[model samples]
Every structure is written in C-alpha cells, then in structure tokens.
Target: MKILLYFEGQNIIGKSGIGRALSHQKRALASMGIDYTLDPKATDYDLLHINTYGPKSLQMVKRAKKLGKKVVFHAHSTEEDFRNSFIGSNQLAPLVKKWLVALYQEADHLITPTPYSKKLLRSYGLTQPISAISNGIDLKKYYPDEKKEAAFRKYFHLSETQKVVICVGLFFERKGILDFVEIAKKMPEYTFIWFGDVPMLSIPAAVRRVVKKDHPKNVIFPGYINGDLIEGAYSGADLFFFPSYEETEGIVVLEALASQQQVLLRDIPVYDGWLNDRMNCYMGNDNQEFEQLIRQLVEHQLPNLSMAGFKTAQEKSITQIGAELKAVYQEVLERPYDHQIYAKVTK
Candidate 1:
C-alpha cells in the first residue's frame, strides 16, 4: 500500500532526534517495498502517517481525513510541547489547538514513542486507540569504525588514547547548554563537544545577535553535521551526554550505545527502561551527578560491551522499529474505528 508521511519541518536535517527520525522514516520506506511520498495529495496513498503534535502536521491530518484517507498521528511529546513551542503565544495558540484537537478526534490511529509521552498525549484529549513505539537507531551506520573514528579524532585534534565525550543539541534553554558549561568547568581534562546551531531557529532578530556571540570555544559548538559525518563522530566518542529538561525520546543515546560507546542519559520517564545506573550509563539527577559519572568513566576504566550492548543494538534498530510501525498502520487501515469525536473530546 502507498503511504504519505508528514513531519512538522525538515529544516537542514541537523543532528537532532527529529533528523534521526526522518532518516529512519526514509530508510524504512525503502525497505518496506511500499510506495511513499511526502506529498499530502498523492491520490494513490492509503495512509498518512504524521509525526508529533505540531500545528503543521495537525493541519495535514485534517486534510487527509477530508480526503477519506487513513490517518495515524504519532505523539512525540506531552501537551507541554504544544504550549511551549513557537505557538505558545495568544495569536497562534487557538489555531494550533484547533488543529491538534482535530487530530486527536479524527485520526484513525495514535502512537507515542516513549511511555512518558504516552501519558502526556492522554492529557491532550487523545482517547482513541493508541500504542507506544520507542524510537529507533541505525545499527549498521553507527557501530565502531576504526578508520572513520581515527579520522574524526585527528580532525578534532583529540588523541585516540584519550577518552572523548560528546553532547549534542540545539542551543535552547531546555537543552541545558549552560549546564554543560558547568560540567566542563569542573572536568577540564576530558574533551567535550556540542553539536547543532541556534541561529537556525526563527527567534526575534534582536535576541539572535546576543546568542550568536555566546558560543564559547571549550564547549566546541560545530554547528550542524549530517550523513556519514554524524556516525563518524559517534564512532570516535567514548561517551554521549544528553541532559535535556524535556524530550519525548532520546534517539542519540541509542546511536551511541549501538556504536559501543557509553551514555550518561538524564533520569526521566522516557529513558526509564533503556538506561541503567552504572550499567549502560551513569543516570544523572543533576550537574554534580553528571560530573561524578564523567569521573567514574574516566578513572574507573569501564569495560566495553559489558552490559548487553549487542542486545540494545538488537532491540532498537531501524529494521526492528519499521516492522513495528508497519503493523500499527496495517491495524489502523484494516479495522473500523469505534469512536470518532469531531467536537472537543476533553475540556
């Protein structure tokens, strides 16, 4: 069957979770032997699989329903994502809410990538049939590559013998860039790198100038990197640090683990089943704990592939997740909906 996939935006395709999600979507479509397009109006398509609770995809969901097509809306975050993003203001709030509520009522299927997000979506009036499908990692693309790994290390002027640590995120308040600054100050010997560029966002012109100058050197903000370059960076790094205040899913943690590197993931609901303290990573409550883990990984000499590293690779790859998503879409198309509420499903 044909399918049309809708995302809020695919800007520059940076090294963020959304970028990885889109990559999985593209690769999975190729493997499934199904004809697919990004076009919302492709007449041959049977289903429209849209990601997130964003306004753009919400509108796409409404249009797909009007055309008598099957609709699947995946929830990547809770209602807080809706009220805090670019649409938080009064002018766009009603329009964004109107479309999101429509997706909740009219879409034939719903999905959330993480358990934390499943609870979040339920709070947004999503009472229809829904399931949890955790995000994916590309095992083949992300494993340890000595050649590329060496090249990346030489390029960054870091020695292969010295352990390398990486932190990647768009420079937003929620990403905790300032937290990294604190972590870096305490542990100066370990190499720390930050990926993603903040100027990409459409913030007010006035604020842009101030944020541009704030990028410091020791933190190593190298803007955006895509394609083989990303995996190369992952291959060389000894560990990945992701301490987001709010994230529905942490795809990079899976990438790092798949590449045989450790992760210091934030202790949150989305990361519950995956990360274990002193196992896959040192689960952190705050900056002090993050630093302590860094010291442990540095001084203690943690063993490589000690705690079911291959098992993690087996569980969270693109091939595995794509198969699960295909099942969800098939179920949505083959079954009839018991409830379809056009009015506001919740107060």
Candidate 2:
C-alpha cells in the first residue's frame, strides 16, 4: 500500500521524542517494502499519516481528508505543546483546540504512544479510535556495550569512581528541570549530567547567569549531543532520571532501557504497563521518593536484575517495533482498529 507521512515541522534532528517517532515511522514504512513518499502531491497511497495537527500539518490533514484518504495522527505529545509553543498562550490555543477537535473528529484514527496519553486525550472529549503504538526502540543504536563509561569520564573530566546520572531534554518546567536541580543538590556524590539544548527556549539572561553560577560541581549541562555521544552517555550512566509532568511518553526511557541503564521516572500512570520497579524502571512521586529510589539503585537492592530480564526488556528491538508500527498503519488503513496490538511484525 502507498502511504504519505506528514510532519508539521522541520527535522528536529538530534533532540526530542518527535525525531525519534519520525525515525520509527520511516523505518516502519521501509520495512513494509511499501512505496512511501514525503510531501508528495500526486501519489496513490493507502493512507496519509499526519504527524501532528499544527498549522502546516492541519493543512495537510484537511487536504488528505478532502481527497477521501484515510488518515492517522501519530500524536505523540499533548495538545498543550501545540497550544503553547505553536500557537502561543494568546487566543490561538482555544482556536487551535477547536480546529484540532474538528480535525480529530474527522480523522480515521488517532495513534498514541502511551495508554496514559490515550486516557488523557479521552478526557478532552476526543471520542475516536485511539491505538497505543509506541515510538519504539532501535536496539542496534543502543546496547549495554555502547555506553562508553570510560570515554564519558575522560571527556567530562569526571572520575571513574564517581557515580553518573543523566537527564535528557530541554530546560522546560514540564520536563522537571527544577526537580532535577533539587535532586542534584541532594545527591552530591553522583555527577549529574543534563544533555539537551537550553537555547531553544527563551530564558532570561539573569536566569541563565544564575543557573551557571549556582551549578554545583556535581552537575554539568552539556548542550545538544549527537547519537554517538548520546549512546555513550546512556551507556556509561548509572541511571536515567526524567521527571516530566507532561510528556506523552518519553522515548528516552526506552533508549535507557536498551542500554541496560536503570530508569527512574516520575510516577506517570502511562508508564505503568511499560516500566517495572528495579526491572525496567523505578517510579517516583515526590523528591523523597526520587531520592530514596536513587539511593536504592546505588545500593542495588531493588528489582534485582539478571542478564535474562535485561535482555527480555531490550528485546523491543528496532526491527520488532518498526514492524508493529507498519502493521498499525496497515490495520488503520484497512479498517478501524479495535483489537490490542503489541505483537505485530512489519510483514
């Protein structure tokens, strides 16, 4: 079947989950042995998968609907991001919400990365078929051996004996940067690393200077990092702490799992079916729980890990996840998706 994948924005090459999701979609399409094109005007395709409902994406979605084409929104984030970043906090949010509701009402299917996200969207009165197709992992890029602990230590001028923790995302409140700051203060023994861009958002010069000035010796904020470096960071790190309050699903957690690094996330319900305490993840509520979990992880007294459990979790390999996505596209195109899908292959 022919399909058109629409991205509302330009490439976010090496930063966030949208890039990861886009990569998965492309890989899934290729795995299906399907002839897919991007931004094609005159193509015969089975479906058109719009990535978002932004201004650009909305136009594409409307046109696809006009052509009587089946469509899916690989909606990986909350409508809040679009309402805030794309439309600003002005009258635009309400306007966009109306348009999105209309677009969603007209959509043949809505694809969500997490069940929690689906439940949340349902609260928004989006009464449509919602499928839980994750923005899955590429195990080849992430593995237990890929984390270069020694290299990371040397590059960051950190001691091999020192503990390392990583938090990947921009300096957004929803990403829980301040929560990380509090965690950094409590854990002076471990070297905390923030591997994401700060310049993307508008921060006051005074706040920037203050963040730099108050940065503890244990904390380091390296700007944007590429894949090799990111793999190395994940490989060498002892833990991944992402306390996001408003993420659809943090794909970074999957990357961390692939590296066999223990995950510590805020107690977000959508993470329930995926993360297991001490097994694939550690869930936290307040700073105390976060601190306690970190201490336990350091002590190695929680979800006991064997090579077997680690391997099983990491088995959500690139080919495996990509195949599932391809099947979702096929199923959505053929008819409305009602059955659960966690074990589908590309073929």
Candidate 3:
C-alpha cells in the first residue's frame, strides 16, 4: 500500500525529538521497501500516517477518513510529557490533552513509542487502536568511533583525565535538566556536557533562570549539535546520563547505547519494559543515587554495562523497527473498519 507519512511544522521542530522521529520513520519505511509520500496531495496513496497533531493535520485526517483512506496517528505528545516543557505548557496541558483525545480518536489506528505512553493515551480517553514501537536507531551512524572521539576531545580541549558524562535533550524541567545540573555540582571531577538548544522565549522563567545562572565549572551547554559531531560526542563520552522524568522513547539513549556507552537514567516507569538497572543501564531515583552511580561507573566498578547496552540497542535496530512498522501497517489495512472493536483487540 502507498502510505503518505506526513508531519506538520517540520521547520518549527527542527533538530528536535519529533523531527528526528520523522526522519527515522522515513528511513525505516524506505528500508522496508514501503511506498510512501510526504506530499498531502498525492492521490495514489492508500494510507495517511499523520505524525503531528496540528490543526492542518487534523483537517487532513478528516478528509482522509471521509475518503475511506486508512488514518494512522503517531502519538508523540501526551499531557504528561507536555507539562514543564515550555513557559505555558503546564497551564495548557489539559487543553492539549482534550484536543489530542479529539484528534487521536479519529484515527483508524494509533502508534506510540512506549507502552507507558500508550497507557497515558488510554487514560486521556482515546478509544483508538494503539500499538507501541521504538523509533529505532541507525547503527552505522551512531556506533563507536575512536578517531572521532579523539578529535572531539581535542576540539573541546578536554584532558584525558577528565571523564566526560553527557546528556542530550531540550532544556526543559521534565527532561531533568535541573537534576542534571545538581548532579554535576555534586560531582566536580567529571566533565558534564548537555547538548540541546532552547527556544529563547518559549522556555519557562524558572528553566531560563537556571540556563542563565553560572553552573559548576565542570558543566557545559554547547547547544544543539548534529551530524558527525553528535556521533563524536556519543562516542567520546564515558557515560550517558539522562535523568529525564518522562519519555515516549528516548532516541538519544538508543544512540548512546549504539555507541557502546554505559547509560545512567532516572528509575522512571517509561523505561520499565526495556531498561534494567545494572544490566543494560544504571538507574537512580534521586541526585544522591545518581552521584553514587556515576562514581561507580567512572571508577570501573561497573563492568560490561556498555556491551550489555549495545546488545539491548540491537533489539531496536532500524531493520527490526521497519519490519514491525510494516506489519502494523498491513494489519491495519486488513482489519475491518470498526474502531471500537479494533481498540479493544489492540488493547
């Protein structure tokens, strides 16, 4: 079937998680030999896979449904994930959730990145068929590179004695940026770097204050990075420290794992099914625990964690994700047009 994989506000979300997700989906679809189009005017398409929940996307969904075309919505944003994201996100969350329910309920099928996010959508009163799939990583682009790492270290003027710990995400409270800074303060010996940018006026006042404040000498915020430099950062960092409070699925975590770096994350419910403490990653609930874990990781007390993470990442490789997506698409096409029954069966 020809699928129209469309995302609205692509320019607005540039280099953001949603943008990366759209890019990954395109690559995955192409790798699976799926015929897809980004053009909304394409008449030959059998399905419309909407990735954004904007007004335009909503209008397209309505038109597609009226035309008897299959409509699949990608659940990238939930109220829970929206809170603490920007200046008015918390105040706007309830309305956003209500709007999402209205939009997603119109879909023939729904796909989210994690079971945790799927559960959140159900809680938001969405009755559409929902499935969880990882927004898989490109192994070749993210794997370890010793030469790149060396260059990265030299470029940053980092000494070999300093163990670099990295986190990548937008500068938002929900991403645990404050917690990350606090941890950096507690561990002065390790060099901490956060790779992300903030839309100047969009961030909350509290988050902006933190960004403007003088952080610990060891901490650095170099803004959003991409291409070879990003790969270099992933490879050069000794450990990946992501204490994000929530995520549908963290693509950067997968990239770090593919780079064969040991990951340390907050012990949140979103990672319940995939990540295990001391197995594929290290988990902590608070700053003290994070500090202890970092100490152990840097001291070589934790062994084989990086290799284990790499192995875990392989399960969500681009090839595997492509196959899963293809299966979901085929199943949705074959199913009868009964939303209630489809929702019940998928749940």
Candidate 4:
C-alpha cells in the first residue's frame, strides 16, 4: 500500500530531533523502494504516517480518517521531556500532555523511538497499539572522516594534541546544558564545545545566562551545525558527552556511536535497554561522576568502547528500519479500521 509520510512545520522545526527523525523515515522509505508522498493533501495514499502533533497534523488526521485511510502517529514528544525546555514549558506541560493524549488516541497505530517512550505513552492512557522503533542512523554519513576531522580542528583553532569533549543539542535545561557547562568549568585542560542553538527569545533565562555569559573559558558555543562540521566534531572530538536528562531516543547518541567515538551519557531511563554503562558507553548520575569519568577517559584509564558502540549502531541501520516500517505498514493495512473505537475515544 502507498503511504503518506507527513511532517508538519518543516520550516519551523526542521533542525529539531523530530524533524531529523522525519528525514530518516524518508531515507528509510526511499532505500526500501517504498512508495510514499510528503504531501499531506495527497488523496492517493492508503496510510498516513505523521510525525508532528500540530493543528495541521490533526487536520490531516481528520482528512485521512474521512478518506478511510489508516494513520500512524509518531510520538516524538512527551510532557516529561517537554518540561524544563524553553521559558514557559514547565507551566504548559500539563496542558501539552492532555493535548498529546487526545491527539494520540485518534491514531490507528502509534510509533515511538524507544521502548521507554512506548511505556510513557501507555501511562498516558492511550488505547492504540504502539511500536518501539529506533530513529536509526546513517553510518555512511557519520563514520570516521579523516579530512573532515582535520578541518574541524583547524576551523576551531584546536590543536591536534589538545583534548576536546563535544555535545550536540539545543540550549535547553532538559538537555543538561547547565551540567555540561559545570563539568567544563571543572576541567580546564579539556575544551568543551556545544554544537547546537535555539533562538534566544525561546530559551529560558537560566540557560540563556550560562550560554551567553556565565560559561567558562574552556567552553565554546559554536551554535547549530550540520554536514561536514558536525560529522567532523563526531570524528575529531576525544569524547562525545551527552548529559541530556530526557529523550524519546537520542539521534545524536546514535550518530556519535556510528562515528566510533567514545561516548559518555547521563544515567537516564531512555537508554536502559541498548546502552550498557562502561561497555558500549559510560553513564554517570551527576556532574561529579561525569567529571571523574571524563578525567579517566582522557587519561586512557577507561576502556575504549567505540567499536562495541559501532556494533550497536549497525543494528539500527537505515535498511533495518526500512524493513521494520514496511512490516508495520503491511500489518496496519491488513487490519480493519475501527470507526466505532475512534468515535468512542473521541467522544
């Protein structure tokens, strides 16, 4: 069956994780030779795969239902991760959860990036069948690139011998930006670089203060980057340090693992199944532990787990994800659409 793959507000959230996930979906579909269209208004598709939960997305869901088509809602955002992000996000989180519940309940099937997220959605009391699929990684784009690595060092004026730790995320409290800065302050020998940005108007004051003024000399905010620069950062950095407190599934973590970089992460539930502490990656509960681990890693006292991490990445390749999506689509298409169930939930 033909599928309608749609992501609302591509121009606005195009650089966000949800946006990147949509791109990965498109690539996966293309690699599998699956027939799909990005147009939400297209009437020729049998199933609609939507990634965003905006008003336009709801409208599209209604249209798809009227056309007797199945809808697969991708749960990329949750109230837990929505809190502590942006200025009024905490205050708005409860309302956001209610909205998510209503929107998600309308779906024929739901897809989330990880099992952790699927559990979260179930707790929200959604009745739809949920599948946990990885956002997957493009190993070709993220693998060790020697030329790009050298250029990254030269562009940042970083010496080849100098130790560098890198993180890629928006300047959000939930992303552990403050903790990253605090760890950077504790280590003067290693340069810490954060490679993403959010509009200053949308950021919380505490995060804004640290990003704009309160950070240490060792810390650098190069802002949002992609293509060669981001790939280079993954390859060139001594460590890929991600201290995010919450996530559906961290695409950056996958990229880092695919690049064969040693990774350090916060001890969060989202990584429970795939990531093993001190195995494929290292996990810390607090800033102090993260600092200690960083020091140990730099001193080469810690074991190199990059190869093991790469193996994990290999399992989540685009081809595998494509196959999984095809199976899910076929299963959904084979099932009868339950109009009575939809009406009961909405009522």
Cα lDDT, all candidates: 0.68, 0.70, 0.86, 0.91
Lowest summed-lDDT stretch of 10 residues in model 4? 338-347
Q: Specify the poorest-scoring 10-residue window by lDDT in model 3.
A: 338-347
**Residue runs of model 3 more than 4 Å from their true location after superposition:** 338-347
Predicted structure 3: lDDT: 0.86
Rank ordering of all candidates by TM-score, starting from the highest: 4, 3, 1, 2
Give the Cα-based TM-score of candidate 1 against the true structure. 0.85
Q: In model 4, which regions exceed 4 Å deviation?
A: 341-347
After TM-score superposition, the amount by which residue 271's alpha carbon in candidate 3 deviates from its true location, in angstroms, is 0.6
In angstroms, give how far residue 325 of model 1 lies from its true place.
1.3
lDDT of 1 by residue, 5-105 (tens): 87765664335577568668767767666678887557678898877565666667666666667887766544444343331233565666566666666
For model 1, the local distance difference test gives 0.68
Better of 1 and 3 by TM-score: 3
Once model 3 is optimally superposed onto the true structure by TM-score, how far is the C-alpha of residue 340 displaced, in angstroms? 9.8
lDDT of 2 by residue, 222-302 (tens): 877866677888877777788887677777777777777777888866677766655656778888888888888766777
Top-down lDDT ranking: 4, 3, 2, 1
Task: Write down the RMSD of candidate 3 (Cα, Å).
Answer: 3.2
